[model samples]
Target: MTAGRVVLIRAVNVGGAKLPMARLREIAAELGAADVSTYIASGNLLCTPPDDPDAFDRALEQAISDEFGYFREVISRTPAELSQALTDYPFGEAPSGHIYFLTGEPSAEAASDFCSRDFGNGERLQVIGRDLHIDYPAGAGTTKITAAGIAKGLGVTGTGRNLRTTAKLIELAE
Candidate 1:
């Protein structure tokens, strides 16, 4: 019995760690998730579990440690929860692969500070409610623009993936 959770794992491929995603699905299976699926090589998992997300988190963490011999920070959100983050994004779909970081709700003061800062690459930042929607028309792998800089301005810890990752997450949730 799989837990109903959307799990996002980070730093899997760092330093050529060889953290096979197939093993990740197997770990989810051991955690008692029934309908287990992985979104991409970036380490996103959509699973239906027998227990609630809290239990799944613990079990999955332990399983991953035992299997991989390392600890990974696992963030789990329900599809509905992530859907709200997507809805709050303000950009009107400018580029196909625009990346946005879904971070903690920035304080009103922090948001105000970010409104005035420039990203050095002529990039634009918008805060729609709690979510930070960044229009990176230049795409990732560029030296000038970065999601981290935007997160720093907003005072939150998060990462952004391409638009392809966003669409797949939505599709898996559906």
Candidate 2:
């Protein structure tokens, strides 16, 4: 059976880094990724990865850097893992929330420390495994819990998807 995975590319098509979705899809296909499809323009990709997930991740990263000269972090998660993250989300029903999936496991202490930090404006955060659920009652645009801040606090790399995008990605994975 082909193993499907979601790949999130960070810092792409933003600032001066231009990674067009069409080029990304073509590159993935050339790298032997099957059924490659991209969601939106923020670098969310769904595909059947090569046999080795770790090797594929590294090769994809290298290919992007080599091809586009844009060295952004790439994070991947299986559909099952993303589904569990959605199931385990603790904030009941939040209309405005984001899920940040980490590339590496953060230390328990780091997670706890990050959770305990005060990110005012009705911001709530919960860390489960490598997934961090953040609800911003005051809107994420104005919130202080940015990707850079999260990486700095947790000592890990991650890419975030808003609730709607998260749900859509899950659906596409299925």
Candidate 3:
């Protein structure tokens, strides 16, 4: 049996987001989630949320906003879905990349526009459903395609976690 969903909160513990993991777990528990846990300080939450996971995602987002005085998108995925992302990774085990978990899959036109846009060399982008896979060989710090750029191009909300961290979250969720 799978553990549950991996709830990822966008841009936490960085740039003054400051969401404490212990408090996060407490919030989830208050919301009736079971087996609540968190990974790292970057807002990776693991739990079997109450009722619908999507609903839980939204509730968590709201709760965080209410309690922490800031808003952040909370995106969740089942263990199977997380595993599928690993399998669907287009870089084929290149070992370094990130998966941007979108609120919903972008439209074909948006995906095409984002794909066609020149973000500079050594950066490969592949849009897979709600996941945007990006591989920037020279390191993300040097990439022209940024989080803001992605949001603008895709016209959607999302949060990104690196490939290794994603694998770790999957392991923890299972």
Q: Which candidate is the best by TM-score?
A: 3
- Give the candidates in order of lDDT, highest first: 3, 2, 1
Error of 1 at 104 (Å): 4.0
Sort by TM-score, best first: what order? Answer: 3, 2, 1
Return the top candidate by lDDT: 3
Q: Tell me the tens digit of each residue's lDDT in model 1 across 48-151.
A: 87777767867876777787778665667777766766665556665733434443677888878886676565556666554556665665455354446665
lDDT of 3 at 27: 95
Predicted candidate 2 versus true structure: per-residue lDDT over 1-174, tens digit per residue? 233998888878888889889998898888889989999999998899768876788888999999887688888888888888888888877888888989888898999999888888878888999988888899988788878888999999798888788888888988
Q: Which segments of candidate 1 are over 4 A away from where they belong?
A: 1-3, 58-66, 69-71, 96-103, 127-130, 143-155
Q: What lDDT score belongs to each candidate, Candidate 1 first? A: 0.66, 0.86, 0.88
Question: Per-residue lDDT for 43 in model 2?
Answer: 91
Query: TM-score for all predictions?
Result: 0.74, 0.94, 0.95
Indicate the TM-score of model 3. 0.95
Predicted candidate 3 versus true structure: per-residue lDDT over 23-95, tens digit per residue = 9999999999998989999999999987998889989999999998999999899988878987898987765
